[model samples]
Target: MAQVSLRRLVKKYEGDVQAVKGIDLEIADHEFVVLVGPSGCGKSTTLRMIAGLEDITDGEIAIGGVVVNDIPPRDRDIAMVFQNYALYPHMTVFENMAFGLTLRRFPKDEIRRRVDNAARILDIGELLDRKPKALSGGQRQRVAMGRAIVRDPKVFLFDEPLSNLDAKLRVQMRTEIKKVHQTVKTTTVYVTHDQVEAMTLADRVVVMNNGIIEQVGPPQELYHNPTTKFVAGFIGSPAMNFIPARLENGAGALRLHLPEGIVLPVPPERTKRYAPHAGQEVLFGLRPEHLTEEKPTDKANIATFQVRPEVIEPMGMETLVHFWLQGTEVSARLDPAVPAEVGRPLTLAADMNRMHLIDPRTERVL
Candidate 1:
């Protein structure tokens, strides 16, 4: 296992189109770092650069403390797993997994030992004799991974390896991959557009936007303490709600004045940090989970408000209540036991401690 470092990495295409802006990242040995962003956000391009599949327009890449700016991909000591399971149909799983070793002319005993060990780790030993066409999608993916594992390369690069699987299969494979990482502890760099995958698997998630790094942190850190509005809005399911509002100093205390005469007091603990922005038009950011049906609890900073739900969706464990505050739509999560009806006023509690204030002009979370 080896650490990888990218120093001021840059990638530009024809017409001076910059796919990846100059960015610096240091990945520790045996760490799983995920590059996550929307389409055209340069995550894939960055991964290809690290894999030596794409030429760098500027800066340098180092693996195991050696600069690989001009190193051929074959000599980079890296293995890549792509979205499509590129397996040979005519070759059995064993043969496919052992192909790389065979080409390198390893001893026959060593090849068999490595292939058997990888198959056991992947739990696909029984399917080793079967051809690619006879295996399931997940099984074929395992074979591809086994092929990489048998090489024992310095780094592992995965480019949306789970994108081709069904949702249920994707979840299963995710666990499998995590298990493999735990067992092998190979330094890994994964690129995917799915935030869920990034949150679940990454030791650190790199959130990219417009070819720039917006934020990089552990999953929970980015979720609860996003420094930028883009990170706050992009890291959660159903997305965090951003409502145009003004932070007013009401009687020496700061309060958020939202649309439709909805006013929420800023928690006492946050007043000091947000005082300078008082009376400024800022975005009120809150996640759906933070807004829920009024419940009895000892939790501090709880505030309640009334709103007539416009749309109610019944998920199995919880119900989602959506309402319109002036022209802006807001959603809240409630218990399934509560009978929430459209056009009926329902009291919901907001955990003020979890709320965020974002500057409208710079889009920074204050």
Candidate 2:
């Protein structure tokens, strides 16, 4: 196992298009760090630079305390798993897993021992005689992983390896991959655009935007305490609701002025934090789960409001209520026991203690 470090790393194209801005990051030994962002956000470029697949325009990359700026990919002591499941059609599972060892000309008995061990760990011993054409997608993916496992490299890199499977298979493979990581405990760097995958698999998730690192933290930390409006909207499942509101001083207290002459009071704990911008417009953020049908027990930090839902979707366990708030659409997750009807008013409670206030001009959390 090894720790990877990137200091002021940069990647620029021929047209002067900067893919990755100068970013510094550290990955500890045996840590599972995930680089997550949308396409064109430079996540893949950063992974490629670490894998020695792309040339760095500036700065340095070190693995296990050694600088590898001029090293070739084969000499990096890393194994990569791709989304396409790069396997040979003519080679059997045993041959595919043992090919790397065969190239190094290990003894026949040693090659058999390594391949057998990896096959047993992956539970693919029964499929050793079968070729890639005869195996299922999930089985082929496991074979690809087994090939990497046999190499016993210092680092493991995954480039969206679960993108090709069906939804059910993707979930199953996710659990399998987690189990493999726990057993092997090798340093891993994963890149994916799916936020759910990043949240579930990563020890620390790095949120990137426009070739820049926005935030890096544990999954729950980013979800509950986002530093920017982009992260507040990106990490959650249904995403956070953003409503335009102005802060005002009301009866020696701070309150938010919403549309339709509605006012919501700020909690006492947050009064000192938001008192400086009493007369300025700010974006109010609240998660869908925080808006519920049940009344909050803490009356001091909860506010009840009534609105007619524009749409109602009934999920198995919970219902989703959609309504308009000052021309902006907002969604609320409510109990299925409470009947939600379209064009009919329903009372909902907002937990003010968990709310977020963001600056409208800079889009930064306040």
Candidate 3:
């Protein structure tokens, strides 16, 4: 096993068009880290640079503590699994897994031992003689993994390895990949645009935007405490609700005023942070889960919204509430058992501790 490190790593294309801004990351021995972002965000470029597929225009990349910026991909001691299986149609599973070893002139006994061991680990020993065209999508993926397993490289680089599978199969393969990582514990870096995949599979997730590193942290940390508005809006499923509110002081509590004749009580902690700038205009950022059907209370003096309900969606355990607040559409998650009506007036209270205040000018969490 090896530890991967990138210090001030940068990549630039022709005409000085920057692809990846300086990125500094440390992947400890036997750790699984994921690089995630939206399309055109340069996540794949970063992975390619690390794998020695693309040249590093600036900075250093080290695998097992050796700077290999000048090394070719075959000499980098890394294995990459692409979205496409890239398998030979005529080669059976055994031959496919043994191709790398065969090219290196490994002894016949050693190649057989390695391939068999990988097949057993992947539970594909029974399909050794099956061709790629005969295997299911998930099975072909397993064979690809088997190829990587026999190589026993220091680092495993996966580039959107599950994008082509069906939804159910994708989820199943996700669990299988995690199980494989647990047993082998090789340093792995996975890239994906799917936030759900990034959240579930990563020990640490790096969120990238516009070719620059926006934020990096544990999944829950990024979900609960986002530093930038983009991070807050991108990490959540229903996306965060952004409402323009006036910053004012009312008695001891800082008041959040809305155009719909609704005024919310900002808790002491929140007021303490925003009270100094009373007349400033700010954006109120709240998650859908933070708003509930219950009445607003004073134990934590959270903000409340009274609006006309537009639509309701019942999802097995919980329901989603849709309404208009201050001319902007917003949604809230509530118990599915609650009865809701269309075009009817309703009041929902938001959790104080779960609330976030963002500066409108800078678009940053306060």
What TM-scores do the predictions have? 0.98, 0.96, 0.94
For every model shown, the clashing-pair count is 1, 0, 0
Order of all candidates by lDDT, from best down to worst?
1, 2, 3
Q: Estimate every model's Cα lDDT from 0 to 1.
A: 0.93, 0.91, 0.87
Against the true structure, whose TM-score is highest? 1
> Over the full model, what C-alpha lDDT does candidate 2 score relative to the true structure?
0.91
- State the lDDT of candidate 3 residue by residue for 306-338, as single tens digits: 667788988888888888865788888887776
Off by over 4 Å in 3: 295-299
Candidate 2 per-residue lDDT, tens place, 203-284, comes to 9999988888889998899999999999899998889999999999888899998776768889988989999999999999
On the 0 to 100 scale, the lDDT of residue 216 in model 1 is 92
In candidate 2, stretches whose alpha carbon ends up further than 4 angstroms from where it belongs are 296-300
User: Which sections of candidate 1 miss by over 4 Å?
Assistant: none
Mind giving the per-residue lDDT tens digits that candidate 1 earns over 307-361? 9999999998999999989888999999999999999889999999999999988
Q: How accurate is candidate 1 locally (lDDT)?
A: 0.93
